[model samples]
Target: MSSSPRRPAVVRRAPGKLFVAGEYAVVDSGNPAILVAVDRYVTVTVSGSHTPGVVISSDLATHPVRRRWHEGRLTADGAQGGGRPRGGPVHVLSAVETVAGLLAERGLPVPELELSVVSTLHEDGRKFGLGSSGAVTVASVAAVAAYCGLELSRADVYRLALLATARIDPKGSGGDLAASTWGGWLLYSAPDRGFVLDLARERGIEAALRAPWPGFAVRPLPSPAGLSLQVGWTGNPASTASLVSDLHRRTWRGTASHRRFVATTTDVVHAVTGALESGDGPGLLHQIRRARLELARLDDEVGLGVFTDELRALCDAAEGAGGAAKPSGAGGGDCGIALLDAAAPQDISYVRQRWAAAGVLPLPVRVALEGIQQ
Candidate 1:
């Protein structure tokens, strides 16, 4: 008699996040940010099937192919070897492959299974500044681990994510993934330097900050409801590699003007963080507007000035609706989120419709609290 094939189990959870303040500045000014995880998430689950291969699915893609362990590369199309290369699936496949390899090393025979992926975040090419990639990575890693009946800590997940990301994108600050895994506002600082020496330097600096950086209180932002509209857009999805390169070049030149701008932005980010927590709507609006104005000034120098008409209009409309607005991603176009309190629900609806008409996609997102869970 033939033995019954073993079935793998499924695992799932949501990824939460929020950018309370200090986003762009965090990269340059060494300012900290106060983040929160609302309720949104990316869900993933794995299960065994009688079939002889692995199957995966999501809105970003359809099933490609299931593959046996060591048979060959498993494409998403369910074909043995005729998979066409694509964006989203490529990453997904890589993640699965890594997990499969890990399992095999642990003496678990590879099993054919179906993998399902879903996300509440708009991966429609928008950077909400809420760590979408990190969140997705965590979710994917978690699913894989669950299927293998393995337990991995948030730190483990974060490390795994960094590895996976390196294989795919290869260049990104691990801050997003750190926040996604840790789930809170943070001042993510790498070693004060870039290596062994840097580590020692960072330790010394932390000892110094232990006495000065903690007595401060960050204010709260007023209720989001006070805003008449919240509009968001996806910018051009600029490469992080390029952004970091420019930062080094400019800073090395000791650009005084850029330094001053960064200082001012740090203050603004601090103010906004306080406002969001305090639920001070008017305060939030004022700070947001100021932040955007400053961003406008630094845009060209920082190579972030290429705003699209949709972004411009959204900013204008937010002000018209008695609120504030700003781009959500790396700028050149990823996504812009706006807030307006003076407008009624109908007004907000109208603004949303208008943006949609303009070919700008809008997403309804709130702060997420639960970071990642099984």
Candidate 2:
């Protein structure tokens, strides 16, 4: 039976993510990246709907939007000409539609759900670029699925969330989605999104979930035994999608340089994975530096604008303090992560001091061990 209107609300939360290694290169299918889920989160609450359609509200938006599926996609109530829903978050809506599609395939009626989202992934109304999009989507999928009497596995939730976000950005690596789904440190490889998208279009979301996704894989990695992850926020927020779009639009897009980038980045990611597995802290830091250099080379070759003055300062400060640091994701300006000797409290303090002097704010967030949580 569908969740009754008198049933209690269902709440799910998902953690934000940091890209430890691999950036632009992970966009291509089968390429690997390292991502760690952070303590910051996006929480989604689903309740019985009172409106004729689903009502959605988010701290990120100015007002709630009422929407109902049109054919299959969510459309705003009273929308003229069947326009797409307005003032509605695309990620949340995608999760809803994807899960709704799954329920339909199961011969179940779609329940009317009112969703409310609150996030700690931002500060002063600005984002930290800590995979807020991915976190929110994962949380939404879990919450809605649970409310509708479906209990999904971690992998199933991830597959649904991946399809939702991939619909928004086809070239995305989905590393953030993986991190948000599994939590902790992980080695992630991109699936052939083309293959999965085709499967979804032809068969359905349920079929896509059960199918073996080519080139997509994730394995957990232990946290370094002797390193501390320090995060520094550059007050400026960056649009990862925009930064990635720049790379894809470049004349260097399909060139030999891009291929070299993919090969070299894959090597760095492998080293990072091995270091974590062996708890080799220093080796992990060294490879992290190499990852930063690889990203710098990619930027030089493609003018991808992956770094800004603030992010450079963020990394330089950490390096000066004897730690290895780099922008967590596509850079531009967001957060940079540093790996410092866990035993060297002094060095960690010094890195924080230097970041402060350079106008970078230190964020106190740890790697979250859980991803989407009930």
Best by lDDT: 2
lDDT of 2 by residue, 229-328 (tens): 9999989999999998887788887788888888888999999888999888888888989988988888787777787887888889888877899998
Candidate that scores best on TM-score: 2
lDDT of 2: 0.88
Tens-digit lDDT track for model 1 on 1-374? 11236545666665555443454555532355444454567777777666666667775555444544434345435444555444445545656665554555456655566777777665564444455666777777777767667677665565555455545644354456555666544445221122322322355322322323221222223344355435465434544446555555655335786666768777886786667567788887898788777767776566655466777776676677666777643455655666665547766776777777776666676554345676
**Number of clashes recorded per candidate:** 52, 0
Candidate 2, superposed: residue stretches over 4 Å from native: 1-4, 78-87
Report each candidate's C-alpha RMSD, comma-separated, in the order given: 7.6, 1.6
Models 1 onward score TM values of: 0.67, 0.97
The superposed Cα distance between candidate 1 and the true structure at residue 134, in angstroms, equals 2.6
For model 1, the stretches where C-alpha displacement exceeds 4 angstroms are 1-8, 16-21, 27-31, 34-41, 49-57, 62-90, 93-114, 119-132, 166-170, 178-229, 234-254, 342-359
TM-score for candidate 1: 0.67
Q: What value does the lDDT take at residue 66 in candidate 2? A: 78
